[model samples]
Target: MNSPLPPLEAPTQSAMPEAMNPSPDRVYIGFDLGGTKMMAAVFDAEFNILSRRRRKTRGNEGQKAGLERIGETIDLALEEAKVTHDRLAAIGVGCPGPLDLDKGIIFDAPNLGWKNVAIREFLEKRYNSPARIANDVDAGVYGEYSFGAGKGARCVLGVFPGTGIGGGCVYEGKIIRGTKSSCMEIGHVQVLRDGPRCGCGLRGCVEGVASRLAISAAAAAAVYRGQAPKLAALVGTDLKEIRSSALAEAIKEGDTVIEEIIKDACKHIGVAVGAVIHLLSPDVIVLGGGLVEAMPKLFVGEVKDAARKNVMDTYRDTFKVVAAKLGDDATALGAAAWAVASLQPA
Candidate 1:
């Protein structure tokens, strides 16, 4: 199989031609829709962010509010960039899913409190521009493949640990949307049966053990049980204050209890990643999101060791585990790349 293209640098203003005489390929807008926030960016063909805006999703306000938020963010971005609708080629959205990608309808996203929302139609109607929507993680993987760490790799797997765990994959320059779009739900993969219940109602899933939510919950439990001294002090009688970051800090301070918790969390993540490596044999596994950022040494080191130990010898040396290069902007850039790719002849 051919290797993937090299990661493109984020385009700068100088990279975009100053002459704004709307070419056939004009600016593309990318939207990353998350449960709490929505980010919109306008990018030229070279993937330079001309303007970007972010707003709260206000999910409790429901779908109407979310759509309005998305529209408002896009409008703000366009206004900031002084770009008109006529100058836009298309809009690409990276949204939470269990979606009908072909139909552009989001089936359900627990974080967004959305169900069966026609996102593409909403964007097209509001912006009067062609629009496309995809799973946010999928967009992240595509973004990484096009302009981040996964560039030049034959297969790339993106693992993100935020409020929840999520993953996306790219194989041979294409996003791998498996049958029914059920492919790459890495967070839900079971690492240990009967260990702990996840939001998805599964026991011992990766999300249950390795996500930020999980880590925070574990910290709270430890504080409640009087097992973590630093966490208890930081919480100061408020268990809710024992968050993932505080726990990570405690580990950095060499707190034995926090170290044990970190080890356990890393072990679960490692096992889940090991399974993914053995199953997909991706050229690179890119890790990102809040948990990894908070505890880079723990997540990266443990996952790499577990994956190497678990995989067969023939495949052991072929895969590399690395950090996601794009950080938070990955999904947005991916949306822009998706728009660009869609416009090209299939």
Candidate 2:
């Protein structure tokens, strides 16, 4: 569970000892492969970012093309860093879907229409370096534990609400996971029986009720009902236009109904966190993703209060809820750090 990289003050940089630095021939690659976009970053031994390349995922192009694009992105990132292929030491990837951890295969990425993709094998064969794969949420949580909001905590449970909700835990500096697959599927936890149907075809899952997509749907309905005039003027009833920033803006413009919808969603998230507290006894709970980043104060405050109210009184004071600091870079950084840790001699 030991981390190879030293603790970092996220969004900032500090010099590391010369003895700790890797030789010129050693470098690392970290890739965040998201549904809509993908990013590849090259890092020095100390985990300082050397260069980056980004591009649209265009997942509809199919898995073969997508994997090729991933390879191309990494090549460009290394090119920008002025590092040769022979200098690469390891590669790390954060991907969405149900993954076979041992085999490093993505069983399914619904958003990408990809199934049974051997991402690890591809990276290893293409670059001739060790490659590690992790669920995107797990990588993000580990990133926070290593360098961001969850720093100094014994256990950190990270919850991110975007198009859907995702949860991951880092304990004693390692991601808490099953032997062959990822765990901590907090979003799928049933909260309200017979409520909304989730994308997973489950009823009353927290994601169906509390995710940004859910919130946007509700906000769009409100706009149609003339219940959120401020929001209607900003984005109308178009779900695609109702982004996190737009929702925050609607609330800022005196849209009480919109605020109420967000508050309700946070309450649902808090309810889930309360259950997690009883199970894991984590010392810190981190709220991250687009929605939380857009409204940190409201998400933190509401979820904190609701969580405290739901947990047993003895558990109420045991944890603190905080907003994530790393933003979009969390998954990539965590994946890179994980690769470094995994590569160390036993």
Candidate 3:
């Protein structure tokens, strides 16, 4: 291979005189619909964000209002970008989903009280551009792979532990989707037998044991028993207010009970990730979400240690485990990039 072997020249008039005026800089819209918040963002061709908008999901208002919020958020983001809807090339949404991807219909998202919603059609009709959808974690992982932590790796597996543990993988530069549907619900994979019930009505799942909700429940119980005075003093007994930041503070104050709870959760996540590694053998395993961000070293240490213990010795050092780098923008950023990739000619 040659390095720095040639210098480029501008296009000749007879060859391509109209190249610059052929098209506008394509801008894409991305929406991240989660249990607690809904965020919309606008991205230039290179995925640099131009503008964004955010609001609570308020799912109790029902699907109609939720759908309206999606549109409104996107509209406001586009307005901030100073890009009219007509100039929009495409749009994508990353939502809590087990979607019918071919039709872009979300099957169920209990967090949002949404069922069988045709999101792609709605976005396309409203914005007059093409649209696509993916599970929020799926979008997030892809975003990291394309532009953040996992970049340049041949394969990337992402596990995000938040309200739930969501997962996704980018293999050989393409998002992995099953023949029948978009799979990879890593959070719902079983971690314990006959354990606590999950939101999906399943027992002993990873989400039931190690997700933020699970940690919050354990903290609430500890506070009720007067075992976690620091957490109680910091956030009260309300599980909703016991966020990762509060947990981090409790840990900073040397709350053994809270640290043990989070460590246990990280171990469960590691077991699940280990299983993923044994099956997929991805080059990189990226951990993201608010929990990991707030307490990164702890999460990284516990997860990598557990994963190392669970995997075969030969496969031990082949994968690097790290925390997500893009922070909150990953899901929305990935959705926009995925939309742009989908629109390109094969």
* TM-score leader: 2
Worst 10-residue lDDT window for candidate 2 reads 12-21
TM-score of decoy 3: 0.88
Query: In terms of TM-score, how similar is model 2 to the real structure?
Result: 0.91
Residues 262-314, candidate 2, lDDT per residue (tens digit)? Answer: 99999999899999999988999999999998999999999999999889989
Candidate number with the higher lDDT (2 or 3): 2
Question: What residue pairs clash in candidate 1, if any at all?
Answer: none
Tens digits of per-residue lDDT, candidate 1, 172-286, equal: 8888885554368889989888868888897889888877777777777776777777777766435456566787777776667777766777677777777877777898988
Query: Candidate 1: where is the Cα deviation over 4 Å?
Result: 1-25, 180-182, 236-239
Single out the weakest 10-residue window by summed lDDT for candidate 1.
13-22
lDDT score for residue 23 of model 2: 66
Q: Candidate 2, overall lDDT? A: 0.90
Cα miss at 204, model 3 (Å)? 1.9
**In angstroms, how far off is 123's CA in candidate 3?**
2.0
| Candidate 1: residue 153 Cα off by (Å) | 1.2
Instruction: List lDDT for all candidates, in order.
Output: 0.80, 0.90, 0.85
